[model samples]
Target: MAVTANKIELMQIADAVAREKSIDRMIVIEAMEDALSRAARSRYGAETNVRAEIDPQTGETRLWRLMEVVETVENDSAEIALVDAQRQNPEAELGDFLSDPLPPVDFGRVAALAAKQTITQKVRDAERENQYEEFKDRQGEIISGLIKRIEYGHVIVDLGRAEAVIRRDQQIPREPLRQGDRVRAYVADVRREPRGPQIFLSRTHPQFVARLFEQEVPEVYDGVIEIKAVARDPGSRAKIGVYSNDSSIDPVGACVGMRGSRVQAVVSEIAGERIDIVPWSEDTATFIVNALAPAEVAKVVLDEEMERVEVVVAEDQLSLAIGRRGQNVRLASQLSGYEIDLMTEEEEAKKRQKEYAERSALFMEVLDVDEMIANLLVAEGFARVEEIAYVDLDEIAMIEGFDDETAQELQARAQEWLENERQALDAKRREMGVEDDLLTIEGLDLKMVVALAEEGVKTVEDLAGCVTDDLTGWTERVEGEKKHYEGMLEKYRVRPETAEAMIAEARARVGWDVEEEPAEA
Candidate 1:
């Protein structure tokens, strides 16, 4: 075959190939270098003394044979007679090697074949790397791609270089996908294998809300705003916390865009999934209020030590605040970093009334009382301890098992328990080493504590007035001890407000420091 051996012209071929394959020319040059080396191996297969070189800049090929000088030519490929060697090198002697450049063997067919194969391999490898790098960091991100095919409810999305699998479980319920239809999905995972790289996709992740934001809001990509947290129940509703680094820029506004354009774009992608964008706040109560947006909240009482929030909403907003199946409140709790308990004004009032009744009561053991006595109490509309404590002994004797002595004993035991609880609470308060203030802590559920706080004992000083006998109701043995209550108060990390409420109530009953604080001047 007719061949052209122009070094400059071959460099042009490297550039052309690099451009066509969207690859570096250096890669083409490297491939060509490797190819020519292989060709040299083929050309001088029997010639151990042969070596080859090519000009990387110009793609020129050259071959040289390192022939040994000998008195006689024993091996034609490796050795030449000293006389012949002297013709090439005048100072050549026996046992000395000589550099003899071989006339250019036409690498026309070999170089062309090698260059073609090498370039093809290099381009394929580059494409594989590019695809891997593109999808690796995109895990958990939402992307829309054409559905290339569907196999038994599993979808294959054409994500440019490769297809990602959307397993059946990860698909939205009843969302139909057809080939050539564009589908929006979450990039659940990316994995590399011997075959190639696999990108696993989904339609059911809560982060899909955030992912949709990334696609719709350019501010997120440009770093003008950031998403702090996301809580979602997919296909229903979601809450996302957003904050702006630039004070002038409202992160929520940026995400929402003009007339809800940005958020609308995301919502459209998710088939109208509702998203609530809230301003992120370090104050947990404020955050919770915002997370439960579109639901009017009247008050948020935070139990900081317990990481809980009591949210008060209007009677009309209770169902809205809680949402269907408690989803809104649940997501708000997660997003705001507080365990939320929602209540309406009416519910709160009822709850307070019940608590007040329990508070004013004397100690009574329902487990110890006979069914006949309990029925009598119920018939007399005295289902609560407060009524039982104040009930007259003459009224109690009207029932079956009560003698005068038993009635007196039951009444006295209730009074003693009530009194003892007050003293123990006062002692705990003094041990707390504080005065003029009370701690309202949560997570203290001891029956004894409840009894003591009901006695209007406000301070630890009042708690010192009671003994173990006061805390023990009619029961013979208390399951938990005083030290156990103390340990729970410390371990459960009751908020200062709850502890204060408990102390104030206790002190009021004990009649110690009865003077109310004067109004602020």
Candidate 2:
């Protein structure tokens, strides 16, 4: 069957709209059918059940006045007597519809305008849907577009089909955007709203640096080299931890390219931001050491349980390690996923002496010892009285000038002092209305229970539900400044592993199933 010239023109219009909107041709044709149906309904009784269909192959249009077969016909427009419906189809049951084919509807002025608006709105909706589906999965991608305009510091980029906006905060600070300038950015997110899909772009995201490296360095894009971590002070400085799966390949050299070519390309893209491609390591200590590049690390003290590190450097290198306004160390901390504290060698020495003096004083007061004896104990690595009480006698006896008898006497004194302290703490705990069942947890002692009471954790269930951070606390970096927060047992020296075990033990004691740690992928 041949299509008429008018039918071919209708198909051509659907094809054109579909191509222009980047939507399916069938969607455009369906929208057209809906527009025509609405126009027909305006001419016919609005309540009448009118239906329209357009053949996809020939653009053949059909219209029908559908009336339901009923025993009693109260509405003549929408209902027909069952006997009269059987004249059209013998199988027309009470629930079925009898179709009466009507002539093609000639659109009047008002109806034509309404139909045009309906089609335009539907096509616009389809276009927005297409845009969302196209860019939703393209997040974290590098996209280039012309800077269309800037509205109150937000740079709007026309991404060919859809528009994306780089919020002021997401843009690199001090980098001005000009209209018609070509800009590349990371597709941060895509959100669907009633109007259209909101495409968010970012120039300051750490991944933007990683992506730049990906494009500049073949090794980075390939599986040979993997960029493990990235941290950026956006357009000022950045540090990335890269690792190589192949033992022969050096990740840092690969990312740097020949004669700084690869790294320089990335730096130029982000407004001359300095890039530090540190080699990633399985050892957290070694990785953090590399992260703080351009400064020699004199010493490193890692508190793995606390996820913090004390990096002591020479006085001359301290300023360089910390960088201008503490940018270097801040990026290092963020890249390494550890709270870092930088100290000069002399400062660290002074810090050590202060701690030793404090520990000596604490021992002298607690165990009824003289300053000389307490200082000796502190020198022997007895930071807490509990450590002296619980340590093996042989280890204490091995100390210079400390015989077996002396070790036994010192241990006895330590244990006696701890018992008295525990009694005082237990009394405080009872006075504070802490539950007695809290003592049933194996690792928790009387002092720890009192500390828990102070922090409002007073029951077995409370301890059971606690996370590692809940008991041991956590540290976070804000504006390049390290903020320290004390946990319930921060003074008692509770390790993260110990906290988790104690929580599990408490849960088991309270008849709750102790959960197992998840297996690594």
What RMSD does each model have against the real structure? 20.2, 7.3
Which pairs, if any, clash in model 2?
Answer: none
Off by over 4 Å in 2: 1-3, 65-103, 357-521
Top lDDT hit: 2
Q: Report the C-alpha lDDT of model 2 over 1-521, residue by residue, as the tens digit.
A: 67899999999999999888889999999899898888999989787888889999999999988899999999998899999989878888998888889899788999999989999999999999989999999999999999999999899999999999999999998886899999999999999999999999999999999999889988878879999999999978898999999999988888888899889888889998888889999999899989988898989999876788999999999999998998989999999988899999899999999999999999888878789888888888889888999999998899887799988998999999888878889889999999998987878888889889888889998787777777787889989887877888877778888888998888787788787532323
Question: How many steric overlaps are in each model, in order?
Answer: 30, 0
- Give the alpha-carbon lDDT of every model: 0.71, 0.89
Displacement of residue 32 (Cα, Å) in model 2 is: 1.5
Q: Which candidate number would show the highest TM-score if scored against the true structure?
A: 2
Question: Residue 231 error for model 2, in Å?
Answer: 2.0
